[model samples]
Target: MSWGVRSILHGLDFVLQNIAWKPGIDSDLNVWSTRWVDGGMPEPVDFLLEEGFGFMKDFRIKDLCYNGGGRNEGMVRLIFKQESVDKILPTPLISTRSHDEVFWPFSDEVRYTVKSGYGVIFGEFFNNKGTLKDKERLNLKKKRFCKTTLWKLPGPQLWKILLWKIITGSLPIGSEFIKRNLGWDPFCTLCGKELKEVETLEHLFRDCDVSSRIWFGSVLGIRTDQNTFLELGEWIINWITYLKGQKENYYGLTHFLVTLNSIWTLRNNSIFRGESFVQKVFFKQLGSLVSLAIKNPVMKITNDGEGVFNSNDSEDLEDELNCLKDALLVLVID
Candidate 1:
């Protein structure tokens, strides 16, 4: 029995001691004459007295003992049996390797991601650390060209196009038939000048006295009446190259690109539309193109360095004013 129950029974026994409700040989003999240990108590697993030993609490009291008395003989026997079984069983051995090395589970995506991120781990194990660090480090300032929105293009591509345009201007010295075939001259329909080998692509676009006046007087607001052929072409290339460098200058870049596109469009219109390229009509169209370009994401120039732009703000007023003047003359009339 547990200690609690044993204590309660001991108290009951004390209360009933020496109480004679009837004669010793009368009803009391049948009631209290039979002792609890004689028949009512449970049998012990083993008795300390049978083993010829005195009760000693210190001698192999496995876990719990009931006051160093004979009451816990069964619990003591149980503890000794448990200790014997534990001694017969061997302890388990643990492996020295890490969990990943010894008990790794396979996962296709995890393995692929690791391999793709760092290449093969075997190479990393064998390669020099300094060499690996150098290969991975990025150096932005060493780049030859700034990134542009036009497919992340470099400045060299613009230089190539400008060079091609210059070469086309020198190709008219071949023959009279070649000059007429290449849209070089139509007898200057207005001035009736004898257009010959001197009338090249550059002459058509910039050198003609009529086109030169329109270009310098209105758009550039500078006198180009005495400007040389090389000077005008150089100016145009420099303007485009600078605009491309400042790609984030959306308000300015948009005006520049759209104006260039419109100028080419006007040239084509004069060649194929069968209409005289009047300066006033062309300027109005160029104005519309500039307005449309400002609203779109094309050169998204913002006042702040981050490139946030308002289509109608005085912040880019100077760029807009210059762009408007240049675009009107270059695209519409020049």
Candidate 2:
């Protein structure tokens, strides 16, 4: 064969070996030979094979399911051993009653793409035991989280992009500039000369005295310096995910994003305009920003005409307002 044709054949062989059949109504997957199970093994081991069922070796996956697309549990239990039956029983059948699809198992969407294919190739060639390394796995997780959760967050598009930059270390912070050898000083302008902390995303957003005060004084009352997370990106993901889970209406998340945006705005104002951090002014701006977010058309108001952003009870609203009042007391004390 020609070299180009040989290469194509080799690629085709690799694809065939890795692709799996998603069970559908018209599945043509062989009961014995197809790698449709989770462990990538073919169904029905040699020891599990009964002499009487030798004639059924050529049967398709559809033969084990009912016409209405439910599994034939009785027949499956009788024909296959418990191990094979265990694997087959949990395999989800497509609800659409369509033809079976061949899918790449590694991707989130289960469709073959050049990126996933390249990842598979890289894992096989460079990784130990054909698995992704820790860094690769983390990158994959971040990509998935961004696609499914971060990008879908309710806010202005610019806010989401800013968050993306922060998590990906793409924000033009001083530490990032130093890493790129851009001839910029890495010391935080926000923290001043005496502290001289490096201006990393984590330090600027979470560890700095200014930022920590804002977080502690906010309605969420988060103590930014107390977290155990080593990385800012992971910390943001974990906190945001927890915030999202706290309320279906996303009150905690909205407050978090608004507070974060306000902090960034304050940081910029300090750097560009030589503005000093004022607690009263910062708290006022934060309260207004959060209020605006609650009033935004995208935010769902409660049914009782209370104009509350989330589905939380009136008691929760009272508690939040009381927290805000307490936060304002910090301005007096400072």
Candidate 3:
């Protein structure tokens, strides 16, 4: 490759797949070599780098993340200043547990964007250099949100993405709609609040009295307090952690995800359908969906329009298939 093409490709490679920094299965990021610090240069791992540690390989950021005492940490402290260590501390990481994950840095929903790619490759073509939005800001959100294993829950891929978007403030809520000059009333459609307090992720999911009741009455029985969790990302991580801790309730996480999705659906209903908020039916449907998810862990988590039924879960699938066939037959007849 020519020098420019080679540089562009190298930058593109970094932009395309190298940016997001989720702590996947044993996947640790170096505070020095990797771009973990957003738009900020890393403080030197001076002594170790002299020995060619970061350039040579095998060593990683996760190596420093261990709760175990001494050994590497002693060297790490000596090698890096307190200021350098501080940046890595608030990584929104719970390192000891979690499976592998891949996320796009452009959006919290992990939706990859060409704009993000351009910004990365062309060096702030779209944003100011060294600013929060210009660099690893997108990757930071990726790291926090990958903390949730909602994708492992039983649901359609799009539904999972929708919830992820909702949690990340990327969904087209009233606030976003207003940004596009869509003539939206910048308030809680449910509560009719003022423009300053629009139906944001916090409003739709937690702050709204209607959504709060859904959480309070559910099997999880947890209502989010903005005083405790200023951000939806924090609230979601805690929620997922709560569900994961419930060992006896294997379906707890699934239940939480399903119920949240239902709540969001109701929010849409209120907005688009002009439907009044109804709690009893929402609760009933949530219960049913949770049960259905337990029986079919792959309920709608696929994209090709086919639900994968586990061999152990073949019951009633034939009848459902037959019903689908009959519906298609009716369409053909008409």
Candidate 4:
């Protein structure tokens, strides 16, 4: 038994004690002896304990009410008062064929419910309120995002799904497709490099010239380099942890995630379609994507001590969001 149930029974032991089993075909209850009437004697028999009411040879307390009405009205009148008879007749009989059953008076239903039992114990104190903890309790001024918090980033389901795929290293990039024997070329879809490389998650999300341009669009004047592409998943974790602690980074990471999602989407579209992975298109798509996905009223717009976003800054923040999640996940696992 759970502590909730045990505590309930412990607190309401008296209620159980007062509950007497009604007689069935077997007639287990001694009607005169049982305490049924308002926790008092079942019947107000004038005779003492030495002199019983009478041998109830045929009828039983349980059989008294079989079909919503009492079969032994005369016998009931003989032992119990009009008030007692009234209470007994409409008691919603336990059984007709099987032996009599005992039930909690808290519920009219046959089975004891968890909600009823829970209510009996903790109804007054149970909290139905959500995870809305008081801010003063923790005194947390700024909401921070870390590796664990990344999974809970509330936005479009596709965004979260892609993120999960990225972290798992199962994203449908060219190299991943060929690894599964999907019979496809594993070359960069977004880059116009002379010598193409296998379009791995590392190449798609980072290292690609197109993606590098997106990062260059950030207002933070963020620069992408060799380190930015190494150990993608660990970098993400470090990226989040580092940014979370810095007031300077603030909500700047939002732009990063958006930029990553946009570049990936464009890369996917460019695989078969004629979608452009140009820096301008990336910035245009990102602004619209972030606005539609992140509709929360309290969301902050971070300015990285740079001028407001314009056409020139598009590449700075654009592909800066794209980073290798799956590659790092494999590295982390290895």
- Number of the predicted model whose lDDT against the real structure is largest: 2
Tens digit per residue, CA lDDT, model 3, 251-331: 666667766666666766666667666666667666765665656543633442223454444556555445433332222
* lDDT (Cα, 0-100) at 129 in candidate 3: 36
Please, what is the whole-model Cα lDDT of each candidate in the order they appear?
0.36, 0.67, 0.57, 0.49
> Model 3 misses residue 218 by how many Å?
0.6
Q: Model 3: clashing residue pairs?
A: 155-300, 156-300
- In the range 1-334, model 4's lDDT, one tens digit per residue, is 9999997888578456434454454444655545442223344435423354345533245545435333466666666665456445433333344565454433334235666456446533223441112231111111121223554443333455676567556677788778889887778867753467788776677677776777777543445573553445433444443444344554555666666676766775676565555555456656655553344222333343111222245553343223223221121111
Q: Which of the two, 1 or 4, has more lDDT? A: 4
TM-score versus the correct structure, for each prediction: 0.34, 0.54, 0.50, 0.42
For TM-score, candidate 3 versus 4, the one ahead is 3
Residues 1-334, model 1: lDDT tens digits = 9999997897556434312121111111321122121111112224443553344322332122244221244553453343222211111111121111111011112122334223323443123521222222111101111222232322123322433344334322223436558654533322224543243444554555655654554443334443343333343444444444342453554454454444445555555554465767666775676665565342355543223333465646556545544543445443
Task: In angstroms, give how far residue 101 of model 3 lies from its true place.
Answer: 15
- Candidate 1's C-alpha runs over 4 A off are 1-198, 217-219, 226-233, 241-253, 302-334
For model 2, where is the 10-residue window of minimal lDDT?
325-334
